[model samples]
Target chain A: MMTSTDAGLPALIARMTGDEKHAAASESTLDVLWVLYDRVLDVTPDTVHDPRRDRFLLSKGHGPMAYYAVLAAKGFIAPEELDDWASVRSRLGQHPDRNRVPGVEISSGSLGHGLPLAVGTVYGLRAQGIGSKVFVLVGDAELDEGSNHEAIVLAARESMGQLTAVVIDNRSATRGWPGGIAQRFAIEGWATATVDGRDHEALYEAFTTPHPRRPLCVVAVVEPKSGQR
Target chain B: MDMRTTFLSTMEEALAVDPRLVLVLADISAGTGPVLAAQRRHPDRVLNVGIREQALIGVTGGLALTGMRPVAHTFPPFLVERPYEQIKLDLCHQGVGAVLVSSGASYDMAAAGRTHHSAADVALLDTVPGWTVHVPGHPEEARRLLLESLPGDGRVYLRLSSQANARAHLGAGFLTLRQGTRGVVLAVGPMLDRVLAATEGLDVTVLYAATIRPFDAAGLRAALGEVADVMLVEPYQAGTSAHHVGEALADVPHRLRSLGTQRDVEVRQYGEVTDHDFVHGLDVAGITAAARAFFR
Candidate 1:
């Protein structure tokens, strides 16, 4: 029900209240999601189930109001469903379910699942001789999950050129990375980029740039964590 | 050949036949494993995710979603317990199926201590619905089960232990090794030999089962004719099959007892798997006593 003509992140989120919403999780990945749906990703409402359409997986699924907002703005889902998210009758839960949601690729409430799922998807797509690309979004804090490191290393070794891992950094990783977040991925032979999360044009450029014969990892540096920012 | 070797060779066959076959490992190497060679042959399909178990399972989900049949392999606890949530959400909850092949069942790696022992692996898997569990007693059975998982989209948990039965069961389901009139003893996986040894003189029929999930309720009911006593001895956990047995015999009044590994108390004492088996009342002497008492 929500169309781009009258919908914004604020209006969509305002519909779902007192439903255990994750404001910070959605806010941190908001700009990244917007940039991907609006300009970077080739998937539209029509091509959601098409094999040639680009695939976007939300690994950072704690706060999905922002994701729902973007999907609604792009006409992937009805705007009216936003008001009853996480309800007993609603298809949406605290975590997004791929079976219930229209555009969700993988169900994620648990951290460290998205990157590996994306790598697997890329490998699967290639096996079927399909060339569509996969993009997965995760939180900086979520990197602490050792699973993401496994995916990072393996994807690079396989030269997963069609896969892209986007880390939305809010300075939340416990015992943070040494040189920088992108450096960790770079050590694993990934083509890396570091950009400001809020800058729309920078985010779009980083996503669109080509990296031959290697998986792409983009570190989107957002504002400081909650309470500090 | 051992179950490990059979599993690898069978997987190689699966890969040769189906282009969709993808093998995922977690830093586990079995004598220059076949998958490693396949990795060189097809660099994209054979993936070693290091020792990360969560991603090992999660990646299988992604591969399955992309219409690939994935086989994720690792130690039991590392494969099942650590990334259980990943299996639940990414694979099961998503209604996608992947073959999870695990090594070191219970104290299979007894020398490796508690970290390697997965006595509760099957029971933990039992908590989740819709998984076909195969505790293969022999390499032949493991080979058959692994080959069977390829063509379908059903989820399967293939448990291969270091301890194997003396003979390969070239077939599946409950094979009637001995006939008796007093009671029926169901032996699961490696427990078959020990059960046969325990009931050497008892007037009880023994049935061996490697595929324990599809329970064979019809076979059990048919085997239960004129017998009201049934004892289930699993190599993994005790009382895991008590409910299944009870459900099968609900209409007919009968006595059902389950005997296997004990999970109630922590057995900090570590030695040979035989010691753990003795502690869990799965030894020959222990199973003999439980069988006699149940039939009495």
Candidate 2:
């Protein structure tokens, strides 16, 4: 039986079914991905390769059913493709490869690859006189990768105004950050927002609010991975 | 000019002409003032990302995504090995390429210990597909190749060596300095002069190559002729060219021997480059002895 939520996401997610599916993983990112694809990002199907178009990099690319659902719903990718999400002929793999998947910015599966890549993307965009905003979505546990620390500190140091890091806090790390995820970004000079992960209005406001001069971090606190809210 | 100086100056020149070229430094290389000067002149173009080699690669991959060609600079261990995942995922897997210019090739800083050495760096990169590796024999070759790597979206590893050939081989596709019917000997990068010295009295053809990637199969095929005995001498690890050579001469029956740094022995002691080179059988005498034994 298909379960429908207030946002009609459960129907979209029902398209992907398998034994190894990260159900909790996809559910955590669904709302944030919807909010960004629906209201925040200036990217569309046509503007993907446009120089000035906004870039939305999915740094936390693990069991990316929610990302696929969001991309398909927004018309960036076809909905039927989600049926064969992990099949041999499916362009949609468990982890997203940007070359094969439309609207996907970087090919990411490794934990720490995204934030640093986003930092570089923002730098490149700024270098070209293209002021398009670059957004990266990372998991709270993903910050455990030392490479993310390198990028987080560097991104804050560079004063990358157009870069935004939306860290989904699901209490996934084994040994969590000392002062929580938002504090890490705050210590590094980013304008931060800690919000309820499932709330649509709060996410939209946090993402759209002016951080001005410094990069912004919206820590979307979600349910723990232990099936507890 | 030395290869390292030319590396800095060529970057400065390229940055001046190409607006799309982004220079990222890891602060592990010998010189930074020239590059930092370029950063000062064009604050947007050059970035010194501190000693973060992993972040260096991450930044380079990011720049490549935005249609900007990045020349990510540092030593081999730091530039290639430390951030290898960054290179593999962010650059190659993402279908974006950057100019990875690495100094202190192999044992260039032999006295600086194994941490500073990168003989296996090219071998590591060869593990990944679609990378063009160039080990320049001279500063002129380094300058030319570095300039060539900037425009294309292809991934390049421009390895600079402290020990250089007294004269440059300007020709392409393996310059044949001496021709013979006994066998053919291919020397890569800074190993050319020593290779030439090693094969002085031997009845074998000598070929000097600065560019190692897309590995000159046609040149090897044409030069092999009837007698197919071949020796590949590289400045990095031994047998690094074995894969390409075997592929190039797959049909022909040939005797091949590769000589370079020894992989088995760690040589835990530190000394001058010559000391390390002697220990690794990289000196001219060692090359000659190995060449004599292989041909016989």
Steric collisions counted per model: 1, 0
Docking class of 1: medium
* lDDT for B28 (candidate 2): 57
In angstroms, give how far residue A195 of model 2 lies from its true place: 0.1
Worst 10 residues of 2 chain A by lDDT: A1-10
Return the clash pairs for model 2, or none: none
Q: Report interface Cα RMSD per prediction.
A: 1.3, 0.6
Supply candidate 2's per-residue lDDT for A96.
94
lDDT of 1 by residue, A1-229 (tens): 2223244776777777544554676778888888888877888988877877889999988888888888888888898988888999899888899999888888887888899899889888987788887999999989998788888988998889999999999898768889998989998999999999888788889999998889999999988777533
**Candidate 1 stretches greater than 4 Å from native:** A1-9, A17-22, A172-178, A225-229, B30-33, B168-173, B225-227, B251-253, B268-271
Query: Model 2 misses residue B169 by how many Å?
Result: 1.0
lDDT of 1 at B150: 75
The per-residue C-alpha lDDT of model 1 at residue B137 equals: 89
Model 2, residue B53: displacement in angstroms? 0.9
lDDT by residue (tens digit), candidate 2, B109-191: 87789888888988989888899999999999999889888898999999998889998778667888898878999999998
